[model samples]
Target: MGTIKRDKGLDNTLKVMKQGYLYITNQRKRLGSENIFETRALGGKKIIVISGKDAAELFYDNDKIERSGTLPKRVVNTLFGKGAIHTTTGKKHIDRKALFMSLMTEGNLKHLRELTRNHWYMNTQKMEQMDQINIYRESIVQLTKIGTKWAGVQAPEEKIEEIATDMDVMIDSFKGLGGKFKGYKASVDARKRVEDWLEDQIIQTRKGKIFPPEGTALYEFAHWEDYKGNPMDSRLCAIDLMNTFRPLIAINRFVSFGLLAMHEHPITREKIKSDDDYAYMFSQEVRRFYPFVPFLPAKAKTDIQFEGHPIEKDTMIALDIYGTMHREDVFENPDDFYPERFKDWDGSPFDLIPQGGGDYYTNHRCAGEWMTIIIMEETMKYFAERVTYDVPEQDLTVDLNSIPGYVKSGFIIENLREVV
Candidate 1:
């Protein structure tokens, strides 16, 4: 057994906020640790940071670590609502996951992809009329509409932007309480507004005031029975309904990232348009190369040994998401933006964990992961093949120091028009 490197500090909480996505990786580099290190933060709360394939395997090992009550209240209240599946454990997790997986049918996914393409085609008309468009802003509106429509939740045209902004804020809230930049106040209010909106829909569903089509997300979750054969709490049902499609909205950032990629790597952009398979690879690379989540936390279920270090029961363990995907041992020249690498990529869940690393059915992996891929692929191909636009001079830099970063100016584009 080996002694794990401990951070020399009373607390490094503020450093994490300032460092953002690179915090853990920065720690490992400074500590000269292989894959695991300990950091004291949140007023000396012991946090074990683990990365790479082995750490992911252990993190998702339900017997070793569990997720219930692991996320901070601020995270739950904003990013994932109370009683979300991200906080489930044991048998309940299985049942709750089944509820989500049921909605991921192949036919349903196809419908979503079609919706993505349709929305993009429509948005181009609006973009063409305008002198310029912020890809990120327009993407939020289009994705929110697609997600709500696919989930059978109808948002009035005027309400789409509001709903989208709220959802986007919820995702951005993952940074937790970090001064004014984290937007803590906005995070709480965003969840409240969205929850109330969806709860009302759940109510209307029950009273038959609204008809969410069968096989759609809102309909299934609204009528869902808990593992104990009881109707789930209305708020939980609404949370799950949002869970179903809100992630589709989450892909809005990826739309911007994918466009940014096209602009930066012009050769790959031309390659992606002609090659469908390469486009999928490009989408996967976008998810891998860009930052989405920084880390995910779980608590040790019992005393366990990992990487020659002891972890006491109930210790908080953070799976280093950004660090894992960018590990050189996993990807050659890890810093480079290369899509071709995925062509020969081994299909290990732990290796490419931008969303998460585990069995989709039985673990806490993003249920809408497939939707992210589908939407990203469609968005990548659309802008690559269907639309012609100019990448105006703007801050295209994606700050590694930002949690869930986007191109600084949202990847500005001007003179948008249909492809010849």
Candidate 2:
């Protein structure tokens, strides 16, 4: 059995995700703790491989399968705070989700689209200066800024960028299980800076009274009271904005993963560029190939059996997203990068899912699914037409169990005009 080692380098992690199961099954002969193998920890809980689509469907029914294991407690405290959204139960979660959905109306969508386009044009030029930049980091900053602005928080780019970086660092601190303590410490400092920044913005907005006379997303939300009818706390509102950024960050990470797949599999890239509808199909393939959250956990609400394994009530169910997507039994040539698999089809077969969903706007299923697709389609088109760069001689191997290496170099956009 391989000992689970902490801090395996990027290269090694990629290797583990891609083939760790093969090593465990055929070579190792038994599932090891070091390997991400499905095993029963507590008595009679069925832990098995699952894909994004199934996970989405299952998590959508979250009430039936209550999330058993805890997400990083530090993350909950730092990013979401003890709000109606983050830690709430029963009616509270439902109501908070509704509040979040209210902000996603067509009016806000238009504003966000305009902001995203402007940011892309403004940032593309900046990218030309560096040999290579982390697209994931870049997208996160832009998206975070956009969300903050929607929340009526306005500040200098430098200041906002600094805050964004701190937020990201706080998020990264919680990468592996049991690292919640590390995140807890970082979140203290990070949370304070963010809260102070948000508090000032709320004060300024209220004082200026420049909000739309009738109502804006921010205005309506700022005025939103809980079930008891008390005014929502301004401090919690800012932290909610921070939580909004988390999913966006995760979305962009998967988007970058899609970009990497396109670069490496130019055939799929060409298919996507040929037609607009292909954009959605291409996204499905990308979702199947590269989702950020690999293992999503849900607790059993009652005793159940999946594939003959008895799962007791209240046990954590580890759904293996990567394994489900890559399973050959469900997908023909599952390893191949093919977009046609999702074209106008039911999309149930391939189990493609970029965003997790058991219910709309719940679990890891992003509320910004449409928003993410729009960005991905537009950005992929830009890169496909405008850029051409050789990947340097290096190991670009990927692992299903580990995070992928973000592209560091080997891309050049020769035709900026093609971005449109």
Candidate 3:
């Protein structure tokens, strides 16, 4: 029955923008509290910021909070798309989620891994003939090809660069104010272009003009039905298909970080090469250590009490994903990059929520999480065992203020060659 601690700010929007991933963690420390606090941002909207495993569990409890009407329109438009699975709740959410989870089966994951390996091999061969290669830029193209093909969408070879650029702009614009309008425009244009393409594919599939492999994402989603058994709207189906395509490309951020990790922690290079188990652990640590998603937003579904503080209905709640992963109580020496920590890890969903926490089938966790890990693991192995590149002197510093901060120089490298 204690009063919830509060920050003395009229609105924290600017502060949050300035502090970035450190915003919530810094607030908890400044207030001398471990978990819950209240602040205002987003035009005086009250936000309840919560961190740690217990808080994450409560934040994701569908009975307590829901995602519908929670995210800003800008986010919905630019990042998730209108009518996306991210905007649904209850039974509708479950149904839409199943459509996504269906694509993550062991067989499909193996297929994706094989596709990733082949694309990486081909890209490296091309890079071997170049003066320098940017891992981030190259990853976007390679993954766009892999993701679209694996998802059963066929982007013409001539259009891959244009499609990849649009996807990149949409992702980059969601986080900062500097280019938000541009991001929104890019999102609108990209959606129109991609949806038009996907709708045509769906029409072709229906008319038997194009044959997407059975069980592939495009085929399943294009033909998916709603909870009530009606077919999904064409635009929504397109959104869901991009959901698969975009996240796979977004793994480029992690690929950049993975290379940075290999550069900084040279021992990991050998460990990842020699042992598959170590590679898995290393991938987990990279996700836990690096900052990708800052927080997840939901709204209080009803009046609720958390840790004795009353939360009014419609209050915005942000589960601090970054802070939770860096909590000292949950992770010993939370700041260090240590892959060995996961060797005996108990695999708690809430504690390691880089994507999200809870059952993948029923909750708001990212559906493509397994695929992200696989891509990273495969990329890590390739960097460690297959490539011999020199990390030239460049700015490797990461800006915490950026929503998806990247290595400043994009982790420049030279003398690229296969480790024969």
RMSD of 2: 6.3
**Which candidate would rank higher by lDDT, 1 or 3?**
1
Task: Summarize candidate 1's per-residue lDDT along 1-420 as a digit string, tens digits.
Answer: 889998778888888878988998888998899799998876678989898999999998988887888788777878888888988888888998998899889999999999999999988888899988998888889999999999999799999989999998888887664434448789788888888899999999988999989999888888988878998889888887888877788787888988888888899878986786988899999999998888988889999989779999999989999889898987889899999999989889898999898998888988888889999888888888898889877888889987768788988899998987
User: Which runs in model 2 stand beyond 4 Å of their true positions?
Assistant: 1-59, 78-86, 179-184, 203-217, 347-350, 361-364, 386-395, 399-420
| Model 1: lowest-lDDT 10 consecutive positions | 173-182
> How would you encode candidate 3's per-residue C-alpha lDDT over 1-420 as one tens digit per residue?
888898778878888888888989999999987899998888777889989999988977888888888877887777778889888888988988988998888999999999988888777778888787888898899989999989999899999998888788778766753223545666778767877888778778767888899889988987777778898777777787889888788888888898998888899998987887988999999899998989888888999988888999988998999999999899999999999999999998889999999889888899998998898888888878888998888889888876777888877777889877
For candidate 1, the lDDT comes to: 0.87
Candidate 3: list runs displaced more than 4 Å. 176-182
lDDT of 1 at 218: 87
Candidate 3 residue-wise lDDT at 190: 78
Candidate 3 steric clashes: 0
Better of 1 and 2 by lDDT: 1
Q: What lDDT is obtained when candidate 3 is compared to the true structure? A: 0.86
RMSD of each: 1.4, 6.3, 1.4
State the TM-score for model 2: 0.76
How accurate locally, in lDDT, is each candidate?
Answer: 0.87, 0.56, 0.86
Tens-digit lDDT track of model 2 for 258-277: 76787777776677667877
